[model samples]
Target: MKTLLLALLLLPIAAIGDDSRQLVKLPPAAQESLRQEMLDNLVAVNEVLTLMAEGKVKEAGEAAETKLGMAAMGKHRGKPVDARPGPHMPPAMHGIGMDGHRAVSEFAAVAKTGDRDKALALLPNLTSACVGCHFSYRTR
Candidate 1:
């Protein structure tokens, strides 16, 4: 009964649709590709955190660079050529994407130094790009 009431209350808002964010229109293939990349990024970040927790900071750094850093750029990760989404993104959005890659690269450098605390401190700088991009735009 309470769930039904909650759904009824939220229905109006759902009908309104969330329009505050900028929509990034892409072809269906590109959409799927970008979505997969984003999911991979999340996993990469998780591995970074988990490795750090396990006291393998250098390994974590390596994983971050390999999976999320600048070296990871231009890798459509087996997506079809038509599914490459970067060129379709708005300039600002593309810039944010690059910033995210650069952030992980910077983090990788610090993490490679084996100074766990310092590397961990830099994580927010790395993730802020992701947060900003997600908040600013939506592919849907």
Candidate 2:
């Protein structure tokens, strides 16, 4: 049983694979902006995890909502200017980013309710998006 649970827990990470090389080069300013965004995301994820560890599930969810949620990003960054995909971001890649944002939103909702089991269950799935995105895209 323990083995099965552990395997399930690891499944998402395992599926991420090792393909996360940076695939595109951006202008220096864009590259630095993206790097900072990634770092901020890392901090948010770490904060949520720490809150969860401390048994503050709802608080963790709030952190996710405020830090990594789609609405939050949209609010801070403004709505995307172009409906068409950008130069480096193809339609498929953009779709992946959208999906990742949605996953983060979903995780935040689950966490907000203080459902520890469900939140724990979704953590790996949530992180898989990050792994998949990093593996699939990068800036030079």
Candidate 3:
């Protein structure tokens, strides 16, 4: 009885772990578009990181703002391509969309006020969202 109870308890944890793993099933065109968007964001984020490391906070903030804006607009194709119904859309993609919007909004607020310190502080959250998205959904 104890062993069975323990197995039952662990089963939910295992299921939750599986739930967090994303398996994206994007069409070829959608895959290409997402790849391009990731590349663009990577470049922009890299530039901002470089600038920030050099203590060019203002320039970094500006670049960050641009990157964030691009993310917000989903500039690759201006929106998520319509995926076929069912498990076509991964959980990570949904997480990315939500987190990306939050990160971008935070960066925008800091950029508008020219708050370099705040912007710099907020950079990690933005980068986290990007990294999180990439880890889950990348074209093979």
Candidate 4:
């Protein structure tokens, strides 16, 4: 059973075949910045989930909007960022990234209204945008 579970977990990585995904060639600095941003985005999503669980809808919305939504574009620590990753990305990948940000912004709007259920329902859409981009592109 443990082996089966391990294999199930590994399946997605195996499925993300190098040949199938587009390789995004970025400057080393830009690549590292992108990696950090992605990690931060994951953490922000988790934070939002935790806030939602605590019925802190306003806080969750603020976190989402400031961390992963449109408000986050070209900014880190609420300061304007110097590294611009979009210019290095292919147009399709850039669009996917924008869509993901937009989705988060939309979810934040609903979350700010304190309609937890409505906001939660939109979570999948934002996550789907993330998943789609990860599945289709790689920066390695």
TM-score of model 4 vs. true structure: 0.80
CA lDDT, every model vs. true structure: 0.79, 0.67, 0.59, 0.75
- lDDT for model 1, on a 0 to 1 scale? 0.79
Q: Highest TM-score: which candidate?
A: 1
Each model's backbone clash number: 0, 1, 0, 0
Q: What TM-score does candidate 3 reach? A: 0.63
Task: Compose the digit string of candidate 3's lDDT tens values, residues 80-113.
Answer: 4453221345554554555565666667567556
lDDT of 4 at 58: 83
Residue-level lDDT tens digits of model 4 in 61-137: 89999988899886533432335577788876777777778878999999989898998887664575676777667
Ranking by TM-score: 1, 4, 2, 3
TM-score, one value per model: 0.82, 0.73, 0.63, 0.80
Enumerate residue pairs that collide in model 2.
Answer: 20-135
Task: List candidate 2 stretches off by more than 4 Å.
Answer: 1-22, 75-88
What are the RMSDs of all candidates, in order? 9.5, 6.8, 8.8, 7.8
Model 1 Cα lDDT, one tens digit per residue, 1-140: 23223333444454465565669899888888888888998898888889989999899899999999999999875667678898788987787778778878989999999999999888775576676676667888
lDDT, residue 56, model 2: 98
Candidate number achieving the greatest lDDT relative to the actual structure: 1
**lDDT pick, better of 3 and 4:** 4
